[model samples]
Target chain A: MNVVGRRTLTVIALVALAIVGALTAEWWLSQSPDRPFGHTQAGHVLGWAGLLLMLLVLAYPFRKRHTPGQRWSKSLFQVHIVGGLVGHLLILLHAGAHLHALIPVLAMLAMGLVVVSGIVGQVLHALAFRTMNEQRRLLLHQGLPEPEVEARLQALAKQEETFRLWQVIHGPLTVTFVALAMLHIGGALYYGGF
Target chain B: MTWPPPFSMYPVLLTATLVLIIGLGWASARDPESFWAPGDLSVHHAGRMSCTQCHEPFRGATTANCIACHADATFISQPDSPPQIFHRQAARERARCLTCHTEHRGTTARITTDPLNPHSEFIFRVTGTQSCRDCHAGVQKPGPKYGLLNNDAVRRLVAKGKGAHGPGRFADCFRCHAGGRTGAERGS
Candidate 1:
């Protein structure tokens, strides 16, 4: 499939997965009136596992900046995407339908925002990268001088920089989510006695 | 110009979320119940809004904190109730107040019962039975009485031997057994 078609399919699949997950959680909670599974030992284990996976997602950005190879960056990106989505699903399960606490509810909202913003950033980045590569190939085919082609690519890069503006929102949302998550954990520990 | 303009609503929305999160944190620090409490405290405990009143740093609402206020024998000792006896005996060693009475479930919430699941240990430890049906087998019909009232341990402690109030005599154990000192009072 073409780039646009592939991208569209990816976005649709992600949205569909999110919707299905949400509906499943709702159905599971509705199965029981007390909905006490979130407080069970199994629920807590799921929460801890999800939290660890989400924390691992941060390694992608760190590795991307430090690793001097494209291959490793690509693999880490995949890990970041998969780990984030799966971690989010586990967290949603751990949360169940217990929406009584304000701090935890806020943390969930922040987490959702972070995931949405990250998905948006991922799509835009993919599009920009593909467009830049295609433009570079076209410039080469046109028999432009190396220096001239380089200059044109630099200009294209500048234009593509607009796509990165999603990071401005994504970065802060991530920090907010982390902070709220920490507070939620601390509160649980303080009040849970376990 | 791209799908997302340089100035989009994304930034505005992000700013609002940040502001709300920060405001919530600040408010919670000042009064945790406003934004941190899972639910409202039961009506009896409503006046004690401070989390630290029952909660100790890193320890949660310990049985010590609970017994601090509820030192009365009425709250601790009920020989007829195996759960109460177990809790009173093991308050320091094994049982926690939160095991049975969980708060922050909204005012009027039943804090006495385990809202999540029945305490399986009660049946296992008190009745020495695995399933509820083992003890409540004939509860449906007028066959044989079951449960803790007929348990040997309870019978021995309540109305069988010397120093035990005879059966059908003391309807209220506390009437004569007042001030029998709790485990907490003994500093055990």
Candidate 2:
């Protein structure tokens, strides 16, 4: 067996398994009963862990830049996509499909915004990735040097279909996520605060 | 062989125990995990040393008695239960503080606190929130035509329209319509 290939697969597997673990914890703990301070706190912790994982998925480019030492990383994109989707699933389990009507409705709006943007981001990101892949294939056919190919991929990453639209949506998306997050926190404070 | 009750009675016994559990929780004033969370309405003041201790009956719950407990003269005991908040409510309708201030009943305060509880009995007719969609169905979206979308969120959204952008009136219909005096304060 190719140890390096196996290790790459192992990393992806671990990330996916962690997502499932978070989801399981979320489900188990939400059913445990909600209290000001109780076992359900574990569920809150897991939910946030899932969100952090999703954010890592969002920050795919930064990771690639920083980790130049590991070139044969074997497609972190797949891991990123799978990890982000798993977080969404786990988040659902954490909330336990029950919430006060007002705050939950507002929360649903924020989540829906995230889901829509994520879908758009995924499609554009996929399309751009595919195009880049095709360009690399064509260059190989034309006998382009490895350096030239690497330069091309870097250039494309800077500006492409998904990244271009992302430039517009990325900031608003951040603002909305952060703003709605503050509102979510405010609601928690209002409900559970002194 | 029989140390206790029969097995056949288990279902009935379980139901009885559950009802007892809820009753105890209710009496004790705490949240319940017994699947009936909302049904758990602990009395706000059942252990009150006396209604008269806190509630000063006026020339039969006169406004003075309201001010007595509701004002700063007495360090307001329960922040949630304030009179001036409802004083203007009582004053505008020429209503006695005792009207909504019925003290003996358990969880009577729920009329104000519980959003689903109806306000039909009160002179303050409208549910502090909305009353229409109580049953009429599907009036909420494509955005409440005559103005049901005026809930707090919508109102804040509309406030945004008003503050930064010029007026359009459609941003938050819920603030005005759901609020008391349909077209008065929030209709702006």
Task: List the candidate 2 regions with Cα displacement exceeding 4 Å.
Answer: A1-46, A55-79, A96-104, A149-159, B1-188
Instruction: Please write out the lDDT profile of model 2 over residues A41-152, one tens digit for every residue.
Output: 5556656775677677755545665785566344777766676567665665555444433334445456546655665566565566677888999988899998999898
Show the lowest summed lDDT stretch of 10 residues, model 2 chain A: A30-39
Against the correct fold, how does model 1 do in TM-score? 0.65
Chain A TM-score from candidate 2: 0.56
Estimated TM-score per prediction?
0.65, 0.37
Model 1: per-residue Cα lDDT over A115-145, one tens digit each: 8887777778777878878888899999988
Which one wins on TM-score? 1
**Candidate 1: residue A149 Cα off by (Å):** 5.5
lDDT of 1 by residue, B1-188 (tens): 23223477779867987897688668878878756676778776997657887988777787777877876365365443444445556554656667667777666444655422132232244335554344343232222233224555455444433544454432323233332211112211
* CAPRI-style grade of the A/B interface in model 2: incorrect
